[model samples]
Target: MDHLLPLSRVAKLVGTSRHALQEMIRSGTLDTFDGMVELNELLRAFPDTKWEDDAEFRRITEIKERAFGKRVFERALPDKEVLAARLFELGNEYAATKALLMHYSQVLSWLDEKIDEIEEDQNKETRHALHVLRAFIVRHLAEIPPDAAKVQALIAQERILKIMSAHVTIKPSGHEFIVESNDTLLEAALRAGVSLDYGCSNGNCGDCRARLISGEVRKVRAHDYVLSQAEKDSGVILLCSCAAVNDVVIEANVAGASDIHQQQLVVKVKAVEVFNPQVAALHLLAPRSQRLRYLAGQSVRLSAHGASGRYAIASCPCEERHIEIQVLRNADDAFSQLLFSGLNANENIELEGPYGEFVLEDASTRPIIFVAFGVGFAPVKSLIQHAMSLDLAESIDLHWLADEAGYYQNNLCRAWADALDNFTYITHASTTEVETTLANIVNDYPDLHRFDVYAAGTAAQLQLAKRVFLKHGLPAQQWRAGATDA
Candidate 1:
């Protein structure tokens, strides 16, 4: 080796300890292929000595725009005094412009509210814009101040209008149902009175995806961050995301959601103990005065100032008042940092919802097959716990899959593993044994059919499991898969 300094040397040069350097490498902040700093990336990550160990802090400030750039215009509607007369007298051009502006105003108001909740130093400027936008929305119509910055933006909007005004035809659904305003198809086909599927008005969960059979749409606010480019390209747009560019034809299958009450809860962390090196069991207790009830498989979004993330409730619905969530520490993940960096314990955090519709149906004893992968074991753990408590039929089978023995709390998982007589733990550790355990088990057991399967995990793992289940003659309709693109 010509001159390779050890990690210790680099740490000393950067005025930090060896342990900090190791943490950085483990979390990918400092890259080292063979004990040598990929000097360029390392320097870029820690441009100053102050950020040597505080890598996340530096990274967050440097990358705020990409993460929190989704701000909406919250300004009030335009003055009716000047434009109302002109707008009323106008034909197609007036109607289109007015509708577009109204959409912008609504989106901006919503965007500002969301931005207000985010606390980051780098987001101050964006937050300021949100404040201004909020004021405009409350006023209903305020002049967009003429500024050098808005000239180009206004030009772009005019171009968009030109593109959108192109004439197109909308195919009628030919039904009698309420036309959901958010659904561009149903909105366009209003004369036909066809319905659209919608669950929560919140776009955080995706349920309103539909095919744009033809024609185009100019989004109201680009609030459809839940959509992937692939989904967009495949003609799938959330009724929540589309505003008709031109009249368009669409296939409509609307699913109605039951009324759900939303609540704000304050949960105190009761325990944060390591289940395994990578997995942790977190117990949170709601305020004694607050009575919050959630279904077995629903998830809650947890928020601490400057941070927010969704975690599936891991405890049974019939369990004690306290809620339990299992968290896997991904060293590079921001939420994981809070968990491991002594920020998760004994802290009071805000929680929203008991969201998602993945719970088991009642009155019908549909055989359930639970397939959990990695940290996805959390929700299955809850559903199983609920089923056991309710004394539901032993007709349920849970298949818990992981890559290694030490991936999660073996003892906690084992506790459930041992107590539930109906449940079978399928431990797959490809890291150790040479055999293809997963494929082999499916191959050997031909009796896997006749049960409904619910699979949750990373997209690839879940997809693989689905393929395997289908290959073994499992009915596609009986299987439910949950995968988050994030």
Candidate 2:
């Protein structure tokens, strides 16, 4: 049997982003069968992949880690039970393959005997042809392929990965993620920036229940929401509690913005990070059970010390339990003033929303251009980090047009640009000629029609940027903008 791997696993094995592999597939440089690549195909595509261990693989992962400044799930051994189940599955595969090989060997032996009997009774020409065929088989079987060691090392690494992590595929929506170590399906999915539907993540609500289409899942966490015998018999499992033992396919809903209801929570301030005199970041941690469920590029209403303001979240949703909002120190805004001076760690703050539609088109694979004007960088930053987490774009270009603040998070942007070849950071010093800057920026994208532009600014600034982008080749509907202020 030809060993096959999914595109996601092939990406991990090759130390390339899924988007890069996708590009290869689209260009016909790599071929896949039913969304899977044969083992030979994978070997052919990545002939230089170092399969001994993770040191070389860590190169790509390290860059992604730097680009996304969040503590991703730990890559460790799986739970003993899940590990045992995976081993059992692998053992079964091994046994079946061995059995087939033995059967093939017996068939070859019988064929040899039959050929000998025929050769003994045949003419000289027929017997000579038979002898030549036998010699050909013996010669090829005796010689090992040149890359046999490489193939063995690669398979060994893949088996270890299989024993440690399991890949998951969500149907209908077609989102994919890996279930690493002890993570439940829902935990892994959320960590991967896949916003599936769920409420009360600890599982009192049945909102997270989905039908398991295939593979084995063990319940890791207890839940109050009990399924009926019928549902249980039909393979219904709580995504929040069940851990996949091996590769799996499931039917689940991928939630959209309107699909997600506004959430309310009282969170504790984690820290107040002031970046110069003009800006500070308010980092808040939600209650473990009631963590905020919001998409990137959306605004949340935050209140502390009798002052409240709506600010775009400056952090990715993948950064679990932690919510970050950048505040511009405005004399007129009490919340901004509090963030700049009064907010301390562990202070209680009210949070509500995730309001606005200025979100990344998660499904779009087009190269993306993000334009942030002044404090407008708040939402754009969130969108950028989220895009990084999801690997949603083929390439990303960030145009941060500074006002008086002047690219306060310049170092962070530089770090991302340095770590990712596909990411470009262009900082515009506080420019009086904003339109000229916008025009110059748009001029760089001669093929704007094939791209998606996400711009965040005040209403006037967004209008100006949108006009410039559309005046170039950008499609009108492809332009998404968020108004940051009056």
Q: Top TM-score: which candidate number?
A: 2
N/CA/C clash count, model 2 = 0
Give one digit per residue, the lDDT tens place, for model 2 in 131-203: 9999998898889999898899989888988998999999998888888878889888877778888887887
Off by over 4 Å in 2: 52-54
TM-score of 1: 0.44
Which segments of candidate 1 are over 4 A away from where they belong? 1-259, 364-366, 404-407, 431-437, 484-486
Task: Report the Cα lDDT for candidate 2.
Answer: 0.87
Listed per candidate, the RMSD to the true structure in angstroms reads 28.2, 1.8
- Local accuracy by lDDT, each model: 0.55, 0.87
Per-candidate clash tally: 15, 0
Give candidate 1's error at residue 237 in angstroms.
44
When summed lDDT is taken over every stretch of 10 residues in candidate 2, the lowest stretch is 66-75
Clash pairs, model 2 backbone = none
